[model samples]
Target: MTVSITDVARAAGVSTSTVSRALRGRPGVSDEVRAQIATVAAQLGYTASRSASSLASGRTFTIGVIAPYIGRWFFGTVLDAAEKVFSAAGYDVLLYNLGTPETRKRFFTRLPVRKRVDAVLSLLIPDEEEAAALRSLEVPLASTVGGAREGFTVVGIDDHAGAASAVRHLVNLGHRRIGMISGASEPLHWTTPLARRRAYLDVLADAGIEHDPKLEADGGYTVEGGEQAMTELLAASRPPTAVFAQSDEMAMGALRALRRHRLRVPDDVSVVGFDDHELAEVIGLTTVAQPVTGQGAEAARLLLEQLDAPDAEPPGHVQMPIRLILRETTAPPSPRGPQ
Candidate 1:
């Protein structure tokens, strides 16, 4: 005979409602009590029917994760960490990645995620229309991208500050002609590329370096794109002695381009990149590192807290810190560097 929740409650010496909440990993049950209830339920062969539990609790126990691109290292890493946090809390994740603006627009138009999730987590800042659609979901909302939205509890790093540090490091090393492999144009709400580029220019101005259009190339935030950008820089009448790629992937590409040209790093062209990607250490690329996992986990936790007490907690922003990790890829340019 299949054991029921009531039988587990009786065996655990707790009320049926308490047993239900504890078994479902809901609030109002202490960890000790929850553990004991879980043990009792397992021993009694009690398994929950998700549909039935959702109907009774009026919650789907699902988190909708929205993002434009999952292939990027940053997005993939964040999603992995956030999924772990949600899984521990007994919640399922629904990914909403369509890979293009057209598809995303069409997906949001119908709002298929409506009433199907207990909370929402966005990996990208939604536009006004997208934001409106998300708000229509009427669920706890949080984000790990951009600054605080009107309704989202955000957890992310300061893009300007992080990028500025990378450029400033090159400037401190006496690199004047610093080229930048920049990300391509993005949507209005996707302001990371703009913020990082602005920092690069602003820092150069501070150090008396004149802006050169020839020094900037669109990398599209991919390895091949970055390699192409670096190749463009090499073709410049006067290539920069140091280069800053907006992402580590691009920096890796830049390194490839330099190697193909038989040029030595730092000795010929010092390179810096943002997002100290996992491969940065192994490849000896100097980069600005942000707490990618921390941001994702904290954003998920904030959403969970809001789910626990909807409309009780004020939405807030968490500006996580970033640091520059100096590695072998950067050094003062050789005296024979481009003039």
Candidate 2:
């Protein structure tokens, strides 16, 4: 027979109401009685019902966390950080990895998150129709994808400025023939990749360097993709003297490709990347550092704020700063490179 909250209360010689308050960590139960109830519950192997708790408090005590992908470093790190925050606040997290079209369709159509989670946090920006559907749920929503979304509480870094700084660093090192390792294109409403890509183009244009269509290769935001893209760049008629990879993972792959081709970094090609990933310093990669963990944590906190007080005003936005970290990977190009 499964032990229940009633068994715990009976064993502790307390009312069911007292047991509920004590086990749930709610107020009104004294420290001494709470300890006895806890001890009894453990000994009896009793567990409280989430449904009962929800009925009493009118809250699911759960937060829905949605992301485009989970295996990637950025997504995993953010989700882990957010989960920590939610766990500490007595809330469970329901993860949704809508990486494929089919999964996304199922999510929106089936509404798995409907009436299940008290609030939602999106790690990737949704399209207008999807956003409208989310809003229809009438729950507090937050995101850490793009900067300052209108209807959602947002926490993100300025992608355009961060990418610009990375490209400008290469330019300052006297590199005109700069190749770009870009990420795959995103959905129409997701502007993070576009913002970063636009920054690269804008910075080059500002420096009076004519755009070379062949200089940019899509990295697909993966190591293998980055290596392949780098190989393509190396085969260009006039290879770049320096390269800027949109992500550290891509930059790492670029480094590998250059090594395979027997080209010395900084001497043959200076390189820069975004996202100061954990292994970046280990490999001495120069990158633009954004607070990935902090961004997720803040997004969770913002959702918590709304959950705590339904009528409370939303926290408009939290735009975290980024830092350009200079490392051994970046330097002035060799004299043999294109002018």
lDDT of each: 0.89, 0.89
Q: Give the clash count for each candidate.
A: 0, 0
- Candidate 2's TM-score: 0.87
- Looking at candidate 1, the ten consecutive residues that score lowest on lDDT are 183-192
Could you give candidate 2's per-residue lDDT for residues 99-192 as a string of tens digits?
Answer: 8888987898878899989999998888777888898888999998876766799898899999999999989889999999987664436777
Candidate 1 TM-score, C-alpha based: 0.96
Note the residue pairs that clash in candidate 1. none
Which stretches of model 1 miss by more than 4 angstroms? none
The alpha-carbon lDDT assigned to residue 152 of candidate 1 equals 80
Best by TM-score: 1
**Scored by Cα lDDT, where does model 2 land?**
0.89
Model 2, 103: alpha-carbon shift in Å? 1.7
